[model samples]
Target: MQSAFEKSISPLGLSFRIWGITQLVFSTLVTALLMQVDVLPDITVVYYVPLISAFLGLPAWLILRIALGLLASSRLNVRSRLDRLRWVIVVLGCGYGLAAGLVLVVLWQQSVTGFLTGFALLNAAFFIGCITQHSVIMAYFHVKPHPTAEARPTPAAIHQEQNRTLKKSYMEQTNKVLYKAIITALLILLLLIPSVFIQNLVQERKSRQAEVVHEVSSRWAAGQTLSGFYLYLPYVVSGTTDSGKPYRIEKQLIVLPEEANVQSVMEPEVRPRSIYKVLLYKSRNVFRGQFRIAPQGDFNLSLVKWQDARLCLNISDIKGIEEKVLVKLQDQQYEMQPGTPETGFGNSGLSLPLASVAEVINGPVSFESVLRLKGSEQLHFLPLAGNSIFTISSPWPSPSFDGSYLPGTREVSDSGFQAKWSFSKANLPFNTYLSDTKFDAGKFGFGITMVQPADQYAKTERSVKYAILVIGLTFSLFFIMEQILKKPVHPVQYVLIGLALTIFYTLLLSISEFLFFDWAYLIAATATIVLITWYVRGHFKSFRTAALLGAVITMLYGFIFVLVRLEDTALLIGSIGLFLILGLAMYGSRKVNWYGNEQQQDQPRLASTE
Candidate 1:
């Protein structure tokens, strides 16, 4: 006589292992396919796959029940017979119930009012009907075996009848148990597959997220570069040259690094040094000799918009010509007449001295002049010659300047002193100048501080809230539904509830795109609550219960909205909300009896004397 375990094990003989391996392989292949498929190409098909598959589980469950029935019949005689009849009833009832439930769901999806109400009502009705049918069938089977009859029989007859009945009854019960077990296992496994897949998918998504961050950082580092320019202008009219008629003199320079040994620098150095000769001519109309920066070539420049910039030159070797120089800026031209301060070139950007001195070849009088220009304005800088060397300038409709030019300052300092002077925007037409102009100025002299973008904080806040709201709402709805509905609600039901929750986020994003977040949340949350409340009321028997659930949902929405709005406290708010949900669920489920139907009433007992 072989043992039961040995017999069972012998029959499975590597088949179970093979099946497990095949399942893993198939699941992996499907995962890969799902990842590779472009959802945009066939979104409808992809979206419906899980939905269709959920309903498919019902049929799989039925088939497994049928197979279990056959298997039980060959072994347990009495239990098998009882089970077969039980399944006949259960299978038929469940089949009708499932069919009706699915139809109602479809109707609800297509039409919210009439069909949806009927649909939800139908599911509730079917659930009750199926349970009633099961109870009736079970009672009938138990009572049917023993019928009212009067019979006086011999010992042999009695014994034989008892044996037969006992065997039949035993087999019937065993078969029912086996069939139920198999059906349950099948349903559970079907649900389990998706859960497992989702877990793996979540892990993969996190990994991809990390990779994306790394990729972005790498790109930013690769694109980093450096470019800008400097200039200086200077001149002298020392009592005119001998053959001079009030002779005027001027010198301009495209300043470069004073050091000639340039090769001692790193290769691919974004910052380079260059110099240009001063192209100068002399005239009473100072503009005649001044070289136009032309807002071109490896340089950035800006001037007041809508106003002409008057280039004035008053080169005087003031205090420190050897070290630095001094230049006084006075308005030589006017825009709307110099009636008030605003009528003049006004204040804008920076104004400093452009000081230079004659540097005779191999002469000690040789001096390099540094011209500092500054202003605050919006402008654009683009690579000139379509290369790395950029030029900054303003477009049309910009400000213009007059009497704005400060004549070149000349100074002589033996020890060389750092020229310190005042530059004010008090001379510009408007208080607000283009940052573009300032940026160019920074490129030329002032170094720009690399910092976070202005909108980064707000954008990050929006994205975090958006993602959390969708994910939290989705999980919350399904979790609540599962809590309220004791019986096994299919994953399809969970998915639908989740979809409704996710739609809230979509609505929020759309409305917030046009309106404020507060208004958007109000509209979206109200709509979601109304629709879900109406559906849930129909799904359950009591409107009050549905309203209560709706209230909880609304509260959750408010909580999420708070999370979205309060940037500083979002984490704390979310954490507390999560805790509250968990505590409520824990407290609610404390009294639940897991072994039997919750709807079943408790048995009453009569008091007994001690």
Candidate 2:
């Protein structure tokens, strides 16, 4: 009689290997197609955020195929009845696989739901086909009759048979352990594919949000900056030529403020454009400074034309000025005009005629101004003084202090925020004279930006980044439960569960816009947990098992939430969490004799048949 190993190359084994290869090839093509789905919509900038996790499906399907091939080889060696029911299930899975592949071809990128359904179906076919093949193999072995004992064998034949049986047993045991591990890994990787798409969706939404912000900012005033209080001193030089003819030349002398103080109070408001909101503000600003020209030996003071002097202040946007501005020079008041008398400054500003204060040129001159302006988003200032002290207060809760200089002191609360910036001449690169027309005032500028604390799209993107870990742990939990209960879960059911998890991100993103991120996350996570738990309860018919699954999922979501909130230390926290989870997994599966369990599960059925 032939040994089991010699009989292993049966037609059924060949067919099973062929099916495995076919499934692997088909899944590889499908995975490649799914990767192309990341092609973004037509926009000025396209971000090819690769859905690399989707590629994991290929290896997962391949692993399942390998498991099925081994199972089939083991079964082919055993003499058994052909189970028609198991054959029917395998045929059905094959049909599903073909139908899913057709669907992918028909609706490549036309519909996201179609693509997801097709992807899930292909995965399900591979998974279900493998499990069904194993079931058929087990049934064949269990129902097979042992050889009659009437014909006694020779001693040498018996010894050879015993050795063959031991080898077969060892191979079967190894295959069983490998089968369970491969299935668990496949399910985890299959779940990860949808998460990649979900992350891509989050990125798309964020890009749209940015477009909306740009549109709104274009209509309203963009960020504004104020750099000013330069003293415009016009002077005339009179001299006698070689022929004793007198000549006069006109010149403008730009003087920086010796000491400056600025105070601003802003009332901010939110304007909603469609679903997006923008920040706008009206500010009441006060400026006070002194400008003095130290007596120099370079020019004769007798020929100075101090009467042509003017006081000027530069502003970024004239449209943002809501009310009239007035400048006070000592005891005299002058109404501000639209343009600066000195055109060489290359700035748009308001000027006050200071030709009347010619007597003040001999000493330090004090000036004051009151400005009422309306702007949007951000407000900035330049340090154009030898000594400058600037203070800004707003009713907006969130403020981003940005620019070349940060606020020396700041306070933030639910009510509002206050900030102060003080700078001296030593802090600036230029001296009292700013002759470079191309000098960027923004370099020395500091500003407060009114912004939202938590953006929904951003948080959603962050959560999606943790998809692999979440899916792996969740799938492992299910696999462990299956091993303990000796109850198998269908591949289709795993796909459904994964789909539900992917939808959680979509629900969270949609709900966050209307509610706070924390509340949205709570609602989305609760809904998903309840759904999956209820489904598992129906499948297992055990409340305790379902509750345990739900608890694990809840913990994962909570852990992810903490990681997202702790942005600065997310990497450290994530590493620690992963290590702890690995320890738990290791401890949980420490005593699980995967092969022993298979033997215990199969032996009783075979014995009963005998």
Candidate 3:
């Protein structure tokens, strides 16, 4: 029942392959089990741990296959050297794991219970590997060596003793790799503290800027919304009193325009507050429309109050009204005043009183109003008439069209922008005319918000979100460099490297406040890369490796910047980028042999003293 691959491989190869597979499966299953208890944070890393483990576990699997496969071959002194290597990896691995756990608790502000839980799971997996290695060793050294044969001392017998000593086991080498990986994972978690703090700092600065904007805008003139220009009508109604006595009550009716047209020319300005800035604008608006107040049976018209009737306009901020608002009805001038809108018969938010005009029961009466309004950030208008058309032009390059409807046509460029909107009575939800204060005009308004193209805090906060990816990958990059160049990197050096990586966010945040995000990112990334590259060169002593590390780090920073700019497709693109990076890591590490040092190939000729 042996397959082609199984039949072709030697018994030694089969055993090595089986042992390699066994460790990987056991580690994966144990990881899955521990995750059930909620040991890890329930965030993006919730998915990263398992995928990273599998990707990182592959090289260790290769090391296992090679280390254990040496069992059936290799000489006496080589076996002794192997024993030394095995012990070194185990001692170093366990020492680093416990030390990292301690650091996580003390310095990183993690709870002891959390550290212990993770440490326990790691130790459990390690112990299982130890047991399995013992079995593999036992399977090989099955027979009891002759006691006299050992005393007589043959080269073969000494070799057997060496193999037994090797049985103390280099399979622990897998644990060393996994432990380093776990340690790196811990360092990444340590980085989360700074990353989160940086994010908070970004948010704090953004809030401060917002407060400044609000304060300055309040003084200058806040955002503006214009609704109505509704024709007002008051009439008397007869009603029964509680004792059946007849009473006359006065009520108001509103007449919507039959056709409405608005034209606004906006002049935008910027006001600075300390380190913050806000956008404000002054606009000239012309509202012209026809009011069709035909005969209606809703109330008795014999008691109509023509002398008291007035037109009303809603301007959200009256302070923004820099000049007098005058209406021309049927070519007659009428000045307006402010009114208490909460009662009714005016703009729903802020009411404007117009000069009294007589009721027109014959046909459509044309009216026009000129308003000089001042406001900050935004200017919006409601289409309250049967037929509404809006035409707006501004010199501000970046305008955010927002609210209930978008412009029917828009043209935007650096020079300025022009937008137009047209709507019919059928397009609106409410009737052309309604009782006083009956309609919520704000529910259907559209206009422009002066939008700044570059916002540093928002971009910095988004970059901080990917802090783990940057730290983990940078540490991983250095770890790989260490393995490839035969340079031993201490766990402390990884901490320093991770610190440098996390500091990139702070650098980006502070610098971006003054500079554009792209430029700030460049400066920060370059500074960190140069500093770390120089430090790495000091430890690695090879110009090529350090430069290569710097290049990869630069690419990592660039990739993260791209992800930050993306809103809709960040997850998909980020996932694909991670997969590609992992593939590169695997490919780069394919030929690595942890135990196959120069001494292994040098195999000195020796006579056994045993």
Per-model lDDT: 0.36, 0.70, 0.70
Off by over 4 Å in 1: 1-492, 597-610
Choose 1 or 3, whichever is better by TM-score: 3
The C-alpha local distance difference test score for the whole of candidate 3 amounts to: 0.70
**Highest TM-score scorer:** 3
Sorted by lDDT (best first), the order is 3, 2, 1
**Order by TM-score, highest first:** 3, 2, 1
Error of 2 at 408 (Å): 2.4
Q: Per-residue alpha-carbon lDDT of model 3 for 1-610, expressed as tens digits? A: 4344434554455445443544454456435543443345564554555565456445545654555556435443433534543554355335434643563365335475335433444443444455465544444433333345435777787887676545334434444666566666656655555564575678789989889888887887888988857766677888789999998887777778999999999999887677666888999999899887666665544656766655778777787888777877888777777763442332333333432344434467888888888999899988888998999899999999999999999999999999999999788887666765555567788899998888988888888877777887888777777776767789888878888888888899888877888999999999999999999889988888889989998898889989999999999999999999999999998767654433443233343445
Better of 2 and 3 by TM-score: 3
* Cα lDDT, model 3, residue 598: 39
Backbone steric clashes in candidate 3, count: 0
Residue-level lDDT tens digits of model 2 in 479-568: 777767767787677778878888898899888878899999999999999999999999999999899889989999999999988878
> Which of the two, 1 or 3, has more lDDT?
3
TM-score of each: 0.35, 0.71, 0.72
Once superposed on the true structure, which residue ranges of model 3 sit more than 4 Å away at CA? 1-160, 239-250, 306-308, 343-356, 359-362, 594-610
Q: Where does the lowest 10-residue lDDT sum fall in candidate 3?
A: 343-352
Better of 1 and 2 by lDDT: 2
